[model samples]
Target chain A: MGRVVVEVMPKPEILDPQGKAVVGALPRLGFTQFTSVRQGKRFELEVDGPVTPEVLAAAEEAAVKVLSNPVIEDVVRVADIEADAAATITSEGLA
Target chain B: MGRVVVEVMPKPEILDPQGKAVVGALPRLGFTQFTSVRQGKRFELEVDGPVTPEVLAAAEEAAVKVLSNPVIEDVVRVADIEADAAATITSEGLA
Candidate 1:
């Protein structure tokens, strides 16, 4: 099985009420270091076969067309889960 | 300024109606490669100063205590955005 991860975030200009609420609540919860918060969406899409480049391309297309509202949100990241794991491992080695 | 990214996902055993709906809709939208879909949450927390270890630690704590509900969600990742960018750059080099 292969999985792709897609992340979508609201446009910076848009007002994010949920984020505002979170930032407001954090201070009360004693996590005062945070100055702002922006809530977004993450999606994991699974396929039966390996995540080929074609699959990733399709996932990216779908991420923009279906998963997010273009007017208000931006597709921030789209990556293969296995590839991401490999990247993390390589990065850890470098670190 | 600094930022931390936190990702939360539904527990494996939990029923995800939104995911189900997405999976059902994918075929209709001509995205037939996907077999399953799971939706989750992503949060970006900003701070006035650089993202220190203490800030990242606080973000992790907040992710568990406030960003996600223990009953149904899991805090999958919490990382400083700048660090993540560095990791990505290193990973790309290896790739």
Candidate 2:
């Protein structure tokens, strides 16, 4: 099977209370260098086989239509994680 | 400024009802090739300087202690997004 990952983030103009709360809590917990925090959703879809372009396209469509409320959010990234092994090996040179 | 992204996902044994709902809805919505879905949280932190190792470590600690319920979920990925530009250039070669 393959995995398609989608990241759904709130629109820049939207007020993310959860993010604000986290940001507020950070300083109290001694993480003072941080400036802002934005919280979002990630969905990992497992398909029956290697993730193809069609699977990505459909997943993107699903992310936009059902995974997030488009009026206030954005689907920022859609990645075919099945290809990650090659990319990781190229970047980290891990065998 | 720089950004650090933390991905929090449910443990393998945990039942993700929200993900299940999405998987169930996909077929009804005409996306049948997908077999499973796992939902998670993504946190984007905007820091005051370049995302250094210290910042990443603190963010990782925060992710483990506050961002996710350790008893139920896992912090799967902690990324220095400031370094993404270099990686993207290497991979996609976008100027």
Candidate 3:
């Protein structure tokens, strides 16, 4: 089991108006220290199977190329990827 | 520093053709045990300020109402939220 994840955020110079709106709405919702909010995105991918050094590299490359914006978003922070399936899959002669 | 995060997944019955494509692409991309893929979306919210019990509650509500589809996506999993600013902000008499 392998998963690729990414974090996306607005460029530092760009204004995050949606974040601002959330922040502005907070006080009324009972938050006082309202200040700044940066909106971002995350992606979760369930991979074909297993995690190896090469597969890890592959996933990272795929993410950068197709899943995320390199200029606006940071590269993925690989986390808790499993290679071994926890449950046993019993196949009658199909191993 | 407050961030509200949510995880979104497609309804089980709805076909996830994109996920299927990714799974099929894996072997070509160098994964051998290629099996399946489930694609999902994650949302990151930077809150106006500190996360209180009430604020936490509010953010969850907003996420359900506007940020996510309650039926298709699970409620946010609030993690590592912070209220204290790490860097010192020297306010010239603006307390």
Best DockQ goes to which candidate? 1
Q: Pick the candidate with the highest TM-score.
A: 1
Tens-digit lDDT string for candidate 2 (A27-54): 8988887899999999999988777778
Question: Any residue pairs clashing in model 1, and if so which?
Answer: none
- Provide the lowest-lDDT 10-residue window in model 2 chain A: A86-95
Pairs that clash in candidate 3: none
Per-residue lDDT tens digits for candidate 3, residues A28-78, read 765544355556554455545545556556556766765557777654243
Against the true structure, candidate 2 has what lDDT? Answer: 0.82
| Model 3 spans with C-alpha error above 4 angstroms | A15-39, A81-95, B17-37, B81-95
Ranking by DockQ: 1, 2, 3
lDDT winner between 1 and 2, please give it. 1
The lDDT ranking, best first, is: 1, 2, 3
Task: Write the residue-wise lDDT of candidate 2 on B5-84 in tens digits.
Answer: 88899998999999999999999989898899999999999998777778888988999988899999999777776454
Worst 10 residues of 2 chain B by lDDT: B86-95
Q: Answer with 2 or 3, whichever has the higher lDDT.
A: 2
Better model by TM-score: candidate 1 vs candidate 2: 1
Computed on C-alphas against the true complex, the DockQ of each candidate is 0.60, 0.51, 0.16
Error of 2 at B60 (Å): 1.1
Poorest stretch of ten by lDDT in candidate 3 chain B: B84-93
